[model samples]
Target chain A: MQFTSERRLDGAVREREFALGEIPGILWTPGSVSAPAPLILLGPPPLGLRKTYPRLVARARHSAAAGFATATIELPGRGDRPRWPAAEQALAELRRAMEAGEPVSDEIVDALILPLVDRAVPEWQAALDALLSLREIGGPVGYSGGVISIGTRLAVVEPRISAAVLFAGSFVPRAMFQEARQVTIPLHVLLQWDDEGNDRQAALDLFDAFGSKEKTLHANMGGHTGVPQFAGDAAAQFFTRHLK
Target chain B: MQFTSERRLDGAVREREFALGEIPGILWTPGSVSAPAPLILLGPPPLGLRKTYPRLVARARHSAAAGFATATIELPGRGDRPRWPAAEQALAELRRAMEAGEPVSDEIVDALILPLVDRAVPEWQAALDALLSLREIGGPVGYSGGVISIGTRLAVVEPRISAAVLFAGSFVPRAMFQEARQVTIPLHVLLQWDDEGNDRQAALDLFDAFGSKEKTLHANMGGHTGVPQFAGDAAAQFFTRHLK
Candidate 1:
């Protein structure tokens, strides 16, 4: 891993950009954390890191102010990362279905999401290895919202991620539900009640599938991108309760 | 309002039992608030005050610690109040249906909840008038859990009640769903996902019917009596946000 750029965000947070092989990622840490701070891995949004920077930096600053280090990696098919023909075809199919006002089929969902999950989970684990090897970042780590399926898969396969805060999005493949039932770590799942592109029942069903003894579903009144500020604050509180 | 008895609870909360005409009620206030404390009217559980005292007082103590006065009144045909034959019959019918593994009919649900909502809303308003008249208790007020139908009606009719934390119980009358759409106050609704007697879909539907633009549904894994401790704390946090 090699850091290509570094900058101080205000005086409270330090931001650094890095590359793990070909995968680009960013790390944020408190400028003044005394002891080793507990680490939280931010899940990259499907829109890519550059476009999602403002929101991600806001989250990073919030977590930094709370005495935690946060990081995120570009998904394999997002941003400047290389995208394969299969992934591009899946996206085109999804757009065509939406343009024709048709339901997104399970095959399209699997093709689009499953491969990303299959690739991203290992890359996240690798990033964890590199981030934790740093002198200041410490475990027990947590994963926060990106793709719901990726979060579910990480919660199931990744042993180091002790807790997660997931945003429920539509088009999750059926196979993810089976993986969801195996997730035992504490979870805080946020759902937008009126998200136009999302199925509310499907989100609730996925929440019910989690085998965690301490899972909470917080559904707020909004469409996608309309999540209330207080909801975000509550998610931070959940991470503080578990990771701290 | 006539004070029936007064006691100091642990030197931090002062508890007073009162009678408004024939209806029995209780009031709790923080011992050290300099200005008038904002009030929260605790909704009386279906199982009368005497039986629910332990839980009610726990909530009272919690709100008191947060610098709020909390109060509750006995429901009509419940607790020390007299029960009419119709109400008694409704209870009997509900129990028989449950024991026989049959669905409780809409008629039974209306008979059981509608009368309570009708009699209780006025009594709660009267209680609010009396409680707020006290020098120690002030508004804006929030109504918290008991029978959800009653909370819905109160949210619709009672102007003083600014926000509510409603427990999404089973058997909410269909009429209340209509009233729920009229409720404009912010709501924080709690649903026990696996409650044996509660209909999860019905709860979800009622949550859907609520017209409040600022509503939240916090669903936790549990049966009727298995609501996790953190869920209760979160409800209190909701009240604090709106009331303060």
Candidate 2:
């Protein structure tokens, strides 16, 4: 990881803006940690992380103040990372199938999600490795933000991540639900009850498929962005219970 | 409706093939109706009422045996009707937006549903007008088959349709849920739980938003065409309870 800038925030938080190879990101930690602190990793939004994502920054600060280090790395096609040309082509084909009133095949669904996940998950794993390597950060990792499949994959593959806060406002490939049935980590899932763009029954199905003995689905009514502010507080509590 | 051909089918059903203006279709009535019988209008499948859709024919025959005259008009772009040339172009634009990972705004959703609904709903209304005018068919109209919003729109505007059996295995505009709230007819909705191309949650949300005093959702597991044989029996029962 290459640190390009360093700063102090809210008087007692240390903020560093850096890049893990090509993945750009920000990390925030409590200014002074006598011992290593627990860590949280925030994933990219559908639009990817931008200055407009005050939510990520605030969550980072929330984690930092709660005595944990927090970090987020840009996913490809997001922030400074240029998009893969294939995503556009794949999406175009999927939408065309939809418009022609054709049933989107499993291959098309795979094209829509797998490539983006494959591109982003490795960067996330690498970023997690780099973030936890820092002297002030310790074990017990939490992952928040979604594309729920990403969290499911990470929970299954990354032993370091102890808990996850999954946003269910995105589509899950049918095969991924089978993968989700293997996710046994403590999980806190958020669902916008009235998300127009999301497949609601699929979200419920994914949640139902989760193998986690300790998993909770927090659902609130509204559109895609209708998650209430208090929902974040509940997520924080969930992370504190599991990660802390 | 102008009758162009007549035949006796499966022993006791009278099959009258007809056209409402430029639209051509088939109607089946139980051979001996002492009085005017209730009518059920089957909406065209996405592929249209072709030989592959033996399901439509079976359902019509089922409704006919249940004592309701059954009819299905050719939706535009199906059978005798030519497809709108702009459907391909609109689909291309939609595909472009999706490829770019753009949020489908209300305008885009409207673009996807309104035109299809606009083209199909009027023809359905016209067909309903013509079908009910026949001496063998009258009163309490039932509409079955869908992308579903077609049924919602018809239920809201077409008073002749006193009940509807909506197939929820299709996309719904976010605004249509509100329109669904205006649907006061008795409804029996069917959903294929594992529909690949559908937003399952949208189907549930639409079902939740229906204002009908008697609305039943029959959700079965499997792919888009996976509605079980029993579902047809239940729907036949629903139409009997309401239309008869």
Candidate 3:
């Protein structure tokens, strides 16, 4: 990991931009810690880091208030990173289905999400490796945010993430159901009950398929992006329960 | 309302046993309070108060520690309260169906839950009237516990109950679905996801049916009585968020 830039978010939080190979990421740490703070990986919605920065920074600042470090890296084809034609083609197909008001087929979901999961999980793991190596960031790690397929794959494969808070999103590949059954870490899943474009039953089924012995599904009354503030507090409490 | 007994649970809480006519109930209040404390009515199952005292007292004490006065009343056919023959016959039918390993029909459910809700809702309202009249108790009221059908009815009818934490249980009458739609208070619902002998789909449907603009369903991986301590803590947090 090479530090590219740095700035203080506030007196309590410091933000550092870094580059790990070709992946660009940001890390936030508490200004001072008596010991190495617990780390939370703030997974974004494949929306690119610049667009997702405000929400990520809010979560990072909140975690810093409780003495934790948080980090996020750009997905393979997201943000300023290079994009591939196949990924672009899948996105076009997904848009066409939505424009025609047709149900998003399993094939389309798999085509769009499977490759993203395949490419993104490795980058996340690489970022995790570098984040943990930093002197200020070490302890039980947590992953919070979505494209939940990537979170599911990470929970199944990443030994360092002791807990996760997954936002239930649409376009989950059916094959990810099999991967979900391998996830054993404690999980806190947030579902927007009335998200217009999301598949509610599919989200519920994925929650049901999780292999974790301790999993919680918090379904709230809202459209997508309408998650309430209290819900965020509950998710933070979940992280505190497992990571601390 | 007549106080039958009064005592201190600890340095922080005071416990008082009371009678509203023939109905028996207990109230817990913070040991020291400047303003009138907020109230939470801790609803228990139809198991009778003697059987459910320990759990009720624990919740009461916990609420009191948060500077909230808490209370619970025995249902008509429960605790030391007089038992009706109709209620007795309903319980007999319910056990017989369960012993035969037959699915609990809606008829059986209505027979069991409807009468309790009918008898219980008014009593809870009356208790609210008396509890709120007390000098030590005031502010926003919350109801936390089950027979979920009772909670549903109370939430719809008792407007002073500005918030509630409803424990999802089996044997809900179909009629409550309509009443659930009328409940507009902020709600925090807890469901034991793998609860033995409980219908998970029905629970999910009830959660979906609730009309509250701010409602949450927290489904945990556990049996009926296996609600973890963290779940309890979350419910408390919910009450604190609204009640305070």
Candidate 4:
């Protein structure tokens, strides 16, 4: 893993760009890491790790100011990664189906979701490995968004993720729901009530399925992008309470 | 609402075929309806309403033999209904994306699923309306098969359905998971542990998310189509207890 162009930011926080294989990311840390600070692995929406996710940057800064290290990586097919032309074509085809009000087949649904899940999980594991290895970060790790399935996979397969704040911006593959039962970590999931493209019922169901005895759902009435800034603050508080 | 080609079977079960608008279905009732018998509305999987779903036929037969009238309707894309060309195109696109390891956007995911949910729910409600309208069938209704989202919707919106047997053979849209919390009816969910196309975790999660206090999950070790014949018998027994 290599981190370059380190820059000092306001509040004595440090920032750097990182890359480990195809996984590109950014890391943030408090000015004085005299001791190991709690760490958070941030996941992004489908937009991946771009400036488009301002909330991510703000959340990371908040964590740093609160004395924790945070990091987020570009999911495959986003950022500097190569886009799968076939997947793009699939998206186009799906759009046509939607326009024409078509009934999708099971094979199609599997094709759209499974490959992404398979590629993302291992990359997340590697990213987590790289983040935790940083001397400035400590145990009691937390994970926040990308697509929910990545978090779901991390929660199930990565025992190190002690807590998670899942964003209900994506669909839950049916298989992942079953995997969710294995995730007994503390969780804070957020949902926007009127997200146009979102399946509101599925979000509620995923929250209900959480195996975490301490899971809480923070639902706000808004569109997909309408999550208020306060929700992020609340998530920060949650991290402070648990990760700290 | 028209019925044609009525037939009587060896077990004193009476069968009838019907067509209403674009929906086509079959109804089965016990030989004698001395009293109001509980009714079950079986939903077809992607395989549609064919001999392919022998389990469905068997379940309906079991229900009929047990003195309950049972029925099943073809999903919009299956059986006598014409396949939605747009939906098929979407499937092909999804296949390409999977083969090329492409990332699917949330909008594409929604397109792939929402249309089906929209089309299937109304058809299910219609089927319920038609079946209950039949003098041979009476109170205490049940639902089984197809993708789980249909069952989730029926459980929430259709107050007359007293119970449901959901098969974990399909994906759970994230929105449907939220709607699941509204379901308060008795439920008997079935799952095959090694369903190839299924994300096993998602099925378990959907089950855990169900809000019903009177719900049971019958999980067996098998493939997607490997639900043991006895599991159907168990589901029949569950219907007997709940629907009867």
Candidate 5:
């Protein structure tokens, strides 16, 4: 079940069409495949990055060159599709979670928040499950990880997520982080000194609560978008070390 | 009349009280004051730094110590008793200006947006007018200026504003740098590398449109809040050089 890079009509850069159950995806591999090489299932930001930015393409290329199978799959309701009404749905779910005093686990949070991702969670899950199923068809899948920005980080803390490299992403309240502490995984945070939209310090404060030795921090040189190169490199290295 | 350090309050800083003209503000003079020092009114951000953040208070204090009569005036819809729906009003005005296809002047923009600055502009203007009306007021009331942040910058481009210092603010498209170029007054922009909510590069790109000699750019090390200290010092210097 080897994947090859080719242009797909879906407008994905170097896409390989595949299906997880009935959910279809384009497996976009960046470079040459080799043994013990990691596979990066990139979860895009809330407004999917594939159509809006070219940096994702650059990241996939770089990661593939580093002996990784990078797939930049399309999330539902993004890219020439009718956009999901995320703001209203997210606010409603946030209110519900707050009222219920429910511990916001990855699954619970995703179930409650997928509609807000601007691409439904079930679709994302289907794509993810499809990517995971590739492990059984092929050989051992060494790594499973993602990089999220701004609002996109909300979906990356899932139990299935092996490791994450977050960039100026928002964090749940202190209570939510505290409740989900047991499910902690290795996380690397790249924070900017003066980022206002996302409080870099607040995110750091939340990361500190993880209390896991696996966490690492890299302060970026510029604001939000400046870290694409840094994130791509760090993510590849992290995948190599942990996933391999 | 020389003014001395009076008092500092520590708590959730009151934006409405300041707006209602309840905060005690001082008039400073180099010698026995004869005329009002040309006023440079600054409109604080919608989210008051002093109220919510300690770092902002320290920065404000530093600016006050630097010889300017500094006040953090509240924007509308943000302080305790808001006079206007801040963001909504601002956005509506912006849309109107854009649709009209006319360049926004400082007065025109201010007239449309001042309700959004809450009572900050009027309070400062009242104080300045009173001080200038004094018989003993010695100095020539030759200039009026301001520093605008976020939405308030739209007000600074008024023809009457002899000088201005803008930080992490955006322009109203066509109005962009037209005010800066047309106004004979000097303008200094203290921009953050990565402003949280605003488009940093887009704002910076407007600088090129300004008449080169009339404008100066200070790319300092901070996010939005991080700018107050660095920007305050630079602004104080800018005011001294131009406003005085």
Candidate 6:
């Protein structure tokens, strides 16, 4: 599965310069699309796991096969080769924009690094807005993030999206959860039992908090990277349930 | 987080003479009883991760805190300390019981390999049954197991349990999913993005089949052991949702 990137300009979809909020990113989209369909906004892990995107791409292909337009965005912070300065700068810009009451330019913020920051509310909001824009293409809209990205997405975007999926994410600060009174959409969380960083109870508490009447929680039986199969299926189901 | 094994059944609960169909396991209860209680049913990995149950007890203590009861069972095939013949013999007995369509005796199984297998399923079930039988128990039941034990539990007992959690488990054969039809309770599945053993999609598809309207899918950031923080939250939320 290969990802080809493009942009929508003047009501016409065209190839646009791929920039992850001023930081560089490898924008990936399906090479072929038959129609205007739902879009998937993929937020990859910000660590050095570029080879990992193939799995994400595989999931995107599944989404495309199911009749949705899909895209996997390599955030500025994480990919085969990451530019740390760009990511740090983006974070600073986000903080300044939020503090100065200015409209943040998502294209200028690093999507991958957004998760690593301890306080990423503004960055999270910017990422959410970018995802929402993609949703305007008219099918279903979905986002998948690793750890910090997933946590921020769940904290900021879960309520707005049709369906959201998180892989190995922890509870946002207790304050973020307290701030989120309820989540109305279907949310799915996947975690490992032996995960040393984000233990099982933390995941369950977040699920309990954001899980709507339609949420579901699944615990697979492996170590950190044991459940690629389930993650793919979750992406498909989330898209199918909402976008289809 | 202290785990002390006892050959003498002085502090044990529900201790009884060996009977038919029982599996050997440890019975761990919290020292204090006033706080929210937690019970961990430890099922270790099939191979390569030695001394699985002891590790689980240590990990669970960190999350379950002091008020919880944790039990680790020995798998039928592995974990025989002092190299007891009972471990292998118990498997033979289990196979016979399965072939004969007889109810497995929990007590007999427990006595035979209590010191041998730690984190096996049959042993886990015996421990769970024992915990539930207690009058002082008013908390949640959490489970952790290896690939085989996890699939076995999902195929055999997931529906019967109120809350179930798994780590890096493989797909429960399609035949089993077809046979089971649905899982009504809350399930937490945690897996890595690049797990080699199981087909991630197949497992998620199975969960999709059984998962309740409320479910969660989390993709951890690390390859094998990404985010450890989520584990604790997942346990707490799962127990709270199912136990309370």
Q: In candidate 5, what are the lDDT values of residues A1-23, reduced to their tens digit?
A: 33443563234334565544433
- Interface RMSD of every predicted model, in angstroms: 0.6, 10.9, 0.5, 13.7, 13.2, 10.6
- The predicted structure with the larger TM-score, 1 or 3, is 1
Identify the runs in model 6 with alpha carbons over 4 angstroms from their true place. Answer: A1-17, A26-34, A48-51, A74-136, A148-160, A170-172, A179-181, A228-231, B1-244
Q: What TM-score would candidate 1 get against the native?
A: 0.99
The models' CA-based lDDT, in order, is 0.92, 0.79, 0.89, 0.76, 0.47, 0.50
DockQ of each: 0.93, 0.01, 0.94, 0.01, 0.01, 0.08
Task: For residues B31-133, write the lDDT of model 1, one tens digit per residue.
Answer: 9988899998899778889999999999899889889899999999988688899999999999999999998899999999888788888988988889989
Output the better candidate (2/6) by TM-score.
2
Which model, 1 or 2, shows the larger lDDT? Answer: 1
Best by DockQ: 3
Error of 2 at A97 (Å): 48
Prediction 5 TM-score vs. true: 0.38
lDDT of 1 by residue, A1-244 (tens): 8999999988669999999999999999999977888998899779999999999999999999898999999999899988899999999999999899998899999999999999999999999999999999988899999999999999999999999999996579999999999999999999999998888889999999999989999999889888898899889989999999
lDDT tens string, model 5, B104-139? 555545554444444455554554455545443423
Q: Name the candidate that leads on TM-score.
A: 1
lDDT of 4 by residue, A92-191 (tens): 6756766787754445545666677888888878888888887788888999866888888888999888889888887567887898887888787777
* Candidate 4 residue lDDT tens string, B1-244: 6886798877588888787776777888888888877888877777777755566667667788888887777777676678887777766776676677775444555556678888988887877787777776789888877778888988899888888888887766778789988889977777775676666778767876888866655555557887755567657767777776
Give the better candidate number (2 or 5) by TM-score: 2
Candidate 2 deviant stretches above 4 angstroms: A1-244, B51-53, B92-109
**How much RMSD separates candidate 2 from the native structure?**
18.7
Contacts from the true interface found in each model, as a fraction, amount to 0.97, 0.00, 1.00, 0.00, 0.00, 0.14
Candidate 6 docking band: incorrect
Badly placed stretches (over 4 Å) of model 3 are: none
lDDT at residue A178 of model 3 (Cα atoms)? 96
Candidate 4 residue runs with Cα over 4 Å from true position: A51-53, A97-109, B1-244
